[model samples]
Target: MATQPTMSEKRWLRALGATLWPSFLVAAGASIVFFANIDPETLRLDSLPGIEISRMSGYAIGFFMFWMVGLASSLLTLLLLNPTPERGPWH
Candidate 1:
C-alpha cells in the first residue's frame, strides 16, 4: 500500500501549484485594463503628459505585484488550513 502524504508536504504542494495560474490570470487582467483605460500617447516619457518612469518599470511593478499577492495568499491558506499531527490511524 502507498503511504499517505504528511500534512506539511501536502500544504507545500498545494501552495506551489496554486500560485502559478491565478497569478498569471490576475496579471494579464490588470494589464488589459491598464492598457484599455490609459491613453497610448501618455505611455511615453518624451510625449506630452507622459509618465515619469520608463516603460520597463511598469512591467516590473506589475510582475512584482502579481507574485507578491499570489505568494502571500498561498501561504495564508496553508497556515489557516494546517493539519494537526497524526496520532496514528486510531485517533
Candidate 2:
C-alpha cells in the first residue's frame, strides 16, 4: 500500500500549479493576440454579446479566456491523477 501525501506537500503542489498556470497561459494568450494582429474593429467585435469591448479590453479578455482554459485543463489533470481509495484483494 502506498502512503498518503502530507498536507503541506499537497498545499505546496497546489500553490506551484496555481502560480505556473496563470503566468504561462496568460503570457501565451497575450503573445497570440499580439502576433495574430487581430483587429476587433474589422471583426466588429466591439459590441460582442451586447457588451462594449475596447481594443485593450479585448486583450484582457483574451488573457482571461486562456486562463480559464488552462484552469480547466489543470483541474482535469488533478482530478484524473488524484489518488482514490485502494480496495484490498479481500475486500
Candidate 3:
C-alpha cells in the first residue's frame, strides 16, 4: 500500500511537472535544430577560446543550456500567471 501525497506535495509535483516537462520538450527541439546547422567544436572554440570540449560534451552542454533557458521562461510565465494575494488597504 502507498500513502497519498499531501496537498503541498501535490502542488509541488504539479509545479515541477509544469516546469520540467515543457522545458525538456523545448530543449530537445532546440538542440536538434541548433546543432543541425552549427558545429559544436566551432561553436565551443569561438565562444570559449583555449577550452577543449568534445562533441558529445558540447551536445550535452547545449541541451542543458537550452533547458535552463526554457526553465526560466516557464518559471517567469508561471509567476506572471499566478494572481497576487490581496493586502489590506494602504493607499
* Global lDDT scores for all candidate models: 0.62, 0.62, 0.87
lDDT of 2 by residue, 33-82 (tens): 65388765444454465666676766666667676667676666555554
Q: RMSD in angstroms, all models?
A: 6.9, 7.8, 4.9
Each candidate's TM vs. the true structure? 0.48, 0.55, 0.86
Q: How many residue pairs clash in all the candidates, one count each?
A: 0, 0, 0
lDDT of 1: 0.62
lDDT of 3 by residue, 4-88 (tens): 9987788778878898999999999999999999999999889997888999999999999999999999888776666564621
Order the candidate numbers by TM-score, best to worst. 3, 2, 1
What TM-score does structure 1 among the candidates reach? Answer: 0.48
Single out the weakest 10-residue window by summed lDDT for candidate 1.
82-91
Where model 3 places Cα greater than 4 Å from the true spot, the runs are 86-91
Better of 1 and 3 by lDDT: 3
Please identify which of the two predictions, 1 or 3, would achieve the higher TM-score against the true structure.
3
Q: Evaluate model 2: give its TM-score.
A: 0.55
Better of 2 and 3 by lDDT: 3
